[model samples]
Target: MAPAGSAACVFCRIVAGEAPAYRVHEDGAVVAFLDQRPLFPGHTLVVPRTHLETLTDLPEESVGPYFTAVRRLTGAVERAMEADGSLVAGNNRVSQSVPHLHTHVVPRRRKDGLRGFFWPRGHYADETEARRIAARIRAQL
Candidate 1:
């Protein structure tokens, strides 16, 4: 059965074989497939078999094995695409379009004309605010 709260999730449906995906690789814990809206031709998404909305939600025990699959897929993507390098990234809740935890492995080539980030960087309003944010994160840690 699909995990709780996973019925509406597209990735979960794909995992359940209720939807179609151009799957590239899959193991007990994770699956890798081509991105529907790809950054490049060979862009792929690696997702956990279980439905977890974000990295923070993933069980600590699952992290190493999950990333092992990611690492393997990264190497495979680079080799298969003949890319000079690859960009591997995961969005938390902020910019994540899908609720499921997944990593983007995009093949990159030199002079491909892709800029640094899709969004613009912003400066902290002031040093006080910056330190406050840092302190909050430090406290959580």
Candidate 2:
């Protein structure tokens, strides 16, 4: 994992594979992976290959490809999970987790029973449990 206090600056190390992650999708410009701590079942994150701190740091041309990936992944998640719809989001203010520019593609369903994810997060109880969850996501990836 990245060193501590990285929450403020950005999480480039995680993106670069300098740190461990259950990486799923990768290409020339973007890397997508399942969220280690997901809000929903098929939650995934898409970030640029370059190390930019925020959305404003991205070039004008970069937005199209990024969103294109997001759009494509939205379909992938929906088809894979058989969901009703999907949630595509970027970190403008409230949804920001890692400072590096990335988009979240969350598959949504009707009876899956989730209100929303605009709230606090609970900590995992132990490493064993976290590992199990990570393993499952890795399989899907």
Candidate 3:
């Protein structure tokens, strides 16, 4: 059966050459394109050809190759935009604008006006609290 929501997924349309995109890179398994609403010029989104919905949905065997593509695109975005650095980020269902999974590689420069993560920062209440949180996550993995 087709992967869930592929019929309506924009990224799947882009992957199938059914939609127009400012494509920067493509391979058998991945596609990279400029974001229409770029945070900064040269911001690109990289996605797997398969319509996996989240990072956890990504097949373990595909993780290395998939991220390798993102890593390469990260460098290219920095060079092309003459940026001092880059932010490579992805969101799960919480902040995800689209249901399709994509990695955002945005060029960054010093004093770019963006502070950390566009949200307030916080610290663990104490070492005990931090350890409890870590242990909870470790149990899942």
Best by TM-score: 3
CA error at residue 92 for candidate 3, angstroms: 0.3
| Better candidate by lDDT, 1 or 2 | 1
Q: What is the lDDT of candidate 1?
A: 0.92
Question: What C-alpha lDDT values do all the predictions have?
Answer: 0.92, 0.77, 0.90
Per-residue CA lDDT of model 2 for 86-125, tens digit only, reads 8887776455676577788888988767766667879889
**Number of the top candidate by lDDT?**
1
Runs of candidate 2 exceeding 4 Å displacement: 1-10, 93-95, 116-141
Tens digits of per-residue lDDT, candidate 3, 27-107, equal 876899999999999999999999988998999999998999999999999999999999999999898887778999999
Give the candidate order by descending lDDT: 1, 3, 2
Worst 10 residues of 1 by lDDT: 1-10
The window of 10 residues in a row where model 2 has the poorest summed lDDT is 1-10
TM-score per prediction, in order, is 0.87, 0.69, 0.95
Q: Tell me the deviation in Å of residue 46 in model 3.
A: 0.2
Model 3 accuracy (lDDT, Cα): 0.90
- Deviating ranges (above 4 Å) for candidate 1: 1-5, 122-135
